[model samples]
Target: MSCQHEESMHLESISQSSTDHSLVVPQCPDDLFVVSQAVKRVKEFYAKHGEIKESHGWNHIQAVCDHTRKALLALDYTIQDNVVVEIQLAALLHDLDDKKYFPNTPPGEYPNASAILKEFGISPEGSRKNSYEKIILMISWVGCSENGNTVPKQVKDTDAYHLLIPRWADRLEAVGSRGVVRCYQYNQEKGLPISSPASPRPQNEEELWAKYATSDKLQEYMDRGGTSKDMISHYYDKLLHIARPPKDIVRNSYLEHQAESSSKDLVEVCLRYGKSGQVDKEYIMSLS
Candidate 1:
C-alpha cells in the first residue's frame, strides 16, 4: 500500500511480517519500494540502538512520517513523487545517527542513514545530484554545532521548500504536551531531574548543547545525577520556542497558530508544576 500509516500499522500489528504482505505498490514505484525498505531498516536500527528511551524512538519516526505525508498532500501540485520519497525517508531516518546515540559520527556525516539509503539506491552526495543527502542535511535541527538550529546552506530554492516538510514536521512533534512528556522521559533516562529551582534558562543553543548533549555529557549527568539541565530548563530553552515566524520554504498559518496555542498550554503546566509541584485544578478544568 502507498499509505504510510496503513503500512506502519500493519508492521506494528503483525509478527515480523514481510513488507509485501497486503502491500499494493503502484504509480510512484520507487517511492513505495524505498519507503517500505526504509521502514524495515528503521525498525531494525531502533531495535538494536534504542537502549530504553522512547524520546527519539520508533514512535517518533512514525509520527514524523505521518506528519510529512499529510503536509505534502496539501502541496501536492508543487511537489514531485521523488521529492515525497526523499522527504519521508529523511523523516524516517533522521535520528539514526543522532549524536545522542552515535556520538562518534561527525555532524552531517549521517553514516547510518547513508548506508541504509545506499541500500535503497539513494546515494548520499549532493555533488552526485542525489537529493537524499540534501534532504537529510536539511531536516536536522540539532547536533550540528556549526549550523545551529536552522536550515543548512546546502538546501537551495525549490529543494529548500521540499526538504523543509520533514524538518517542521519533526519540530511539530517536539511541541506542546507531547514535547513535555518526551523531555521528562529523556531527563529520567539521563538521571537529570524533572525540575531544578537553581539553574537558569539556557541563553542559546550552544549553552544548551554544552550542558546536556553528547555521550560524554550523558555519562556526566548520570554520574552526578543532576546538572543545571533539567526538564523545565529544557522547555524554556527549546520546547517552548517550537513555533517560529514563517520562512520562505513554507508557510502554514494554521499549523503555526496551533503550535503556539499548544506551546502556551505546555508552558502554563510547566510553570504551575515548577512553582507548586502540582497542576492547578482550575487550569486542568479549562483544558477539558
Candidate 2:
C-alpha cells in the first residue's frame, strides 16, 4: 500500500490552552496548557508519520475530546478542575500510538506519545504526569484484556477507579453515529472491503494483517487464535455491541441517542457495498 505522509492535517492550534481554570461553565484554564500541549504534540506526530488512518487519527481524537466534554457537562458529575484536565488530556491523546496506526508499537510504550509528552515537560514527578499516563493506559482496551494488563496505580476515585469517567466519555465515539461513520471510513480509507461484494479481497492477507493487526482489538483476534481474516468480521465480533437497542452500555440520554442512531448506521453500512456496489441484492432481499 502506498503511504501518504505528505498531506497536511491543517490541525488548529490548541486554543483552549489559556482559559480560566475556575470557570465551570464553558472551557477551563486547566486544559489550556496541558491539554493544548498534548493536542499540539498529537498533530505534530501524525503530521510527521503521514500514514494516519481516519479511524485512529487526529480527527478521531478531536471527536473523543468533544464527546468527553459533552458527557462531562451532561452528566454533571462533581469532579475537580484538575482531574477534568487529566481526563481531557487522556481523551485527546488516547490514540496517539494506537495499534491500528502503529502496528509494531505496543501500548504504554508509544515513543512518539512519550516524546511529545516529555517535550511538554510531562515528567514523572509532575503533579498530573503520572495521572496522565494511567489515564492513557486505561484507554488501552486491548492491552487491558489481552494479557491481563492493568494500571495498578489509579486515580483518586474509588467508585469509578477502573471504570473511570473519561474512559466512558472517550468510548462514547466507538458506538454512536460518529463511531459508525468512523468504522466504515476506516475501511474505505484503507481500501479494505467490509464484505466480498463491497470490495474484492486484497491479494495480500499477510500484508493486510500487518497493518490491521496493529489495532489492539484486531490483535486480540489473532491472540485468541481466532480466524477472522477480514475486517467485517470485526463488526460481527465487536462493533455491533457498541450501540443500544441491541445493547445498552451508554448511561446518559445524549449518549443513548448517539448509540441508538449509530447502531442503525452500522446496519446501513452492513448493507452498503464498499468502493464497488456489487452486493447480491437478490440474496439480501431473500434475507428480508
Candidate 3:
C-alpha cells in the first residue's frame, strides 16, 4: 500500500480504537508504522492490565505525547525520524511498567515496552531498542519537581536532549490547569484531603517520598484518619517549585507561564477557602 493510504488506515484505526483523535502520525513510513502499532498496543495493554489510572490514564499519555512532539519542534537541534520514533514510543509507554500500577513486577526491565517492540519485529540487540529502553526508563524516574532535579548519571551521559525532551514534557504536564485537576483527582482517589493546615508539609523529595511513597507509609497516613499532607500542599511542596529549563534548552514558555499562574492562583484560592470556608468567586471569574 502507498504510505498515504497506510497512514489514512492507521489514523482511522486509531480513531476507532480510542476516544482521543489528537494523535498525529509521523510522515515517515517506518516511523508511522511503528508509532501506530505502539498506540494500538498501548491502548490494549492499558485496557487489559489496569484499565486506567486516575491521574496517569490514557488521557495523560496523550497529553504527554502531544507535549513531547511540541517540545521536539521547539528544539534548537534537528530531530531525525528514528529519534522521533524513539521519543514518541517512550512517551507512549513511559508508565507501562509503573510500580504504582504493576507493583513488584521488576525494576528497569520495561517488560511491556519490550514486548510491544518485539511484536514490531525490532531486534533485541538493535541500538534503537536500547535507546527506547533508556528513554522510557529515564522518563519513569523523572517524578515531581523535588526528585526531578537529580538526573541519573547514565542519562546525563547519553544523547541528553533526546531524553530531556520527553522528561521535561512529562514534568510540564504535572502543573498548569490540567495539573491542578490531576492532583485533585489523585488525592480524591486516595481519600486524601484538599488541605491540612495543622500538618507540616514535607521539605524535600526524600521526606515527601518517605511520607507518601510506599504502601506502608501511605497506609500510615490513611490510618491516621485525617489529613497530614493535603493535596493542595502538593502544589506548595512540589508543583510550584518545578525547575525552569536551562538557557541552552528551548523552553515552552506558554506552558511555563500557565503552570506558574494557574498553580499560584489555585494556592491562593485554597488558602482563602481554608480561612473563610468559601471558594474564591473572583478567582473563578478570572479563569472564565
Candidate with the greatest lDDT versus the true structure? 3
In lDDT terms, how accurate is model 1?
Answer: 0.58
Better of 1 and 2 by lDDT: 1
Q: What TM-score number comes out for model 3?
A: 0.69
What are the Cα lDDT values of the candidates? 0.58, 0.50, 0.58
Model 1, residue pairs in steric clash:
1-23, 1-24
lDDT tens readout by residue for model 1, 1-288: 555544444434442443332222222545677678778888888888757368889877776676665565445344445665666777777778777667688755888888888786667444434676555665564332232234555555435555666667777767655655665567667876766664333444455435523334333433453333556655544554444424444454434544555665555655576557653446644553
Tens-digit lDDT string for candidate 3 (147-208): 33445556567546456556666766666556666666676676777666643344444554
Write candidate 2's Cα lDDT for 34-117 as tens digits.
666666667777677777865667666666666565555545245555555656666666667766677788534766556655
Counting only residues 3 or more apart in sequence or on different chains, how many pairs clash (N, Cα, C under 3 Å) in candidate 2? 6
Better of 1 and 3 by lDDT: 3
Clashes of each: 2, 6, 0
How high is the lDDT of residue 234 in model 2? 58
Residue 172, model 2, lDDT: 55
- Which regions of candidate 2 fall more than 4 Å away from where they truly are? 1-31, 141-157, 161-170, 196-227, 245-253, 271-288
